[model samples]
Target: MNTPPSKDALREFLASKFAEAVEQNPDAVVLYAAERAPDPKRYVKRPTVQEVAFKRELEKMRDDQADKAAPESATSVSPAIRTNQLSLDDYPGLVLPGKHNEF
Candidate 1:
C-alpha cells in the first residue's frame, strides 16, 4: 500500500502547478505572489549633506512645537462614532450566532 504524501511535498507540488499555470496564462492575476526579492545593494544612498540639513531643520521644528503647548482641540477626538461598528449579534446571515461572521 502507498503512504500519503507529506505536507511539504504537497505544498511544493501545488507551488509548481501554480507556477506552470502562471506561465500558461501570463495575464492571470496573482497580486500576493512575489516573483523576486529586492536587492539591498542596488538601492541608491541619500546625500550626506542633504540628510544632515534635513535632520537639523526637523529638530528645530520639533523644538519650536515643544515650546508651545499643543491645543486641546488638536488632541481631543469626537466620541460620536465608535469603531468595529457592527456587533456580531447585530450582523445578518450569521452561520452560528455569538460567533464571528464574514463581512
Candidate 2:
C-alpha cells in the first residue's frame, strides 16, 4: 500500500512540475496563462458618436443655464465720487481746546 505525500511534498512536486513545463514550451504556457487572464477588452465598449455629441450638448446647456441664472447687473457698478465734505478738524493731530476737558 502507498501512503499519500505530505502537503509540503505535494506543493514542492507541483512547483517542480510547473517549472519543468514552463521550461519545455514557454510560448504555449504564456498563451495558456493569457487565455485564463481577465480580458480588459471584454469590459470595454466603444462610445457612439451620438453619445459623445449628446454629452457635449449637455455640458453646453449647463453653461448656458449658469449664464442665464447670473444677475443681469453682475458687471455693472457706479464710479466713486469725489467729495469736499471733510474738514481739517476731521484729520488726526488737529488739536481742539475743549476736546480733552470732556475726558
Candidate 3:
C-alpha cells in the first residue's frame, strides 16, 4: 500500500510523542514530522459524478417506494382484502415428531 500518514495526523502523533519524550527526559530532542506535509497529488481519488448520482438516485427511488408503502399500512379494513388463518390441525406433519410431544 502506498498509504503514508496525513500531515495533520502525523503532526498530532509527533506532538504527542514530543510531549511523552519531554515528560520522560526534559533535555531530549525528538524532532519528527517537520516537513512531512500531506501531498494533494498523492491523495486518494474521489468518487466519480456518475457513481455519486447513481447512489443518490437509487436512494431517492427507495425512499419514494417506502413513502408509497407507508400509506397502505393503515389498520382500517374495507372488507376487500380477505385474510385466512389456519390451525395446526389443518396441516398434518407440519410439526416435528419431538415438538408434537410438547403441543
Top candidate when judged by TM-score against the true structure: 3
Choose the strongest candidate by lDDT.
Answer: 3
Which digits, one per residue and each the tens of the lDDT, describe model 1 over residues 1-103? 9999999999999999989988999789547866697666876777799889999999999987876646535656433323535554454455564566557
Query: Where does candidate 3 clash, by residue pair?
Result: none
Ranked by TM-score, the better of candidates 1 and 2 is 2
lDDT of 2 by residue, 5-67 (tens): 999999999999999988997875633334566656656677899999999999999999889
Clash pairs (backbone) in predicted model 1? none
* Sort by lDDT, top down from the best: 3, 1, 2
Report every candidate's CA lDDT: 0.74, 0.73, 0.79
**TM-score between candidate 2 and the true structure:** 0.31
In Å, residue 75's CA in model 1 sits off its true spot by 58
- The sequence of per-residue lDDT tens digits that candidate 3 reaches over residues 1-103 is 6899899999999999989988999878656767877666766779999999999999999999999878677655433443455555556669856666764
RMSD of 3: 19.2
Q: Specify the poorest-scoring 10-residue window by lDDT in model 1.
A: 77-86
- Please report the TM-score between candidate 3 and the true structure: 0.35
- List the candidates' TM-scores in order: 0.29, 0.31, 0.35
Q: Which pairs clash (backbone N, Cα, C closer than 3 Å) in model 2?
A: none
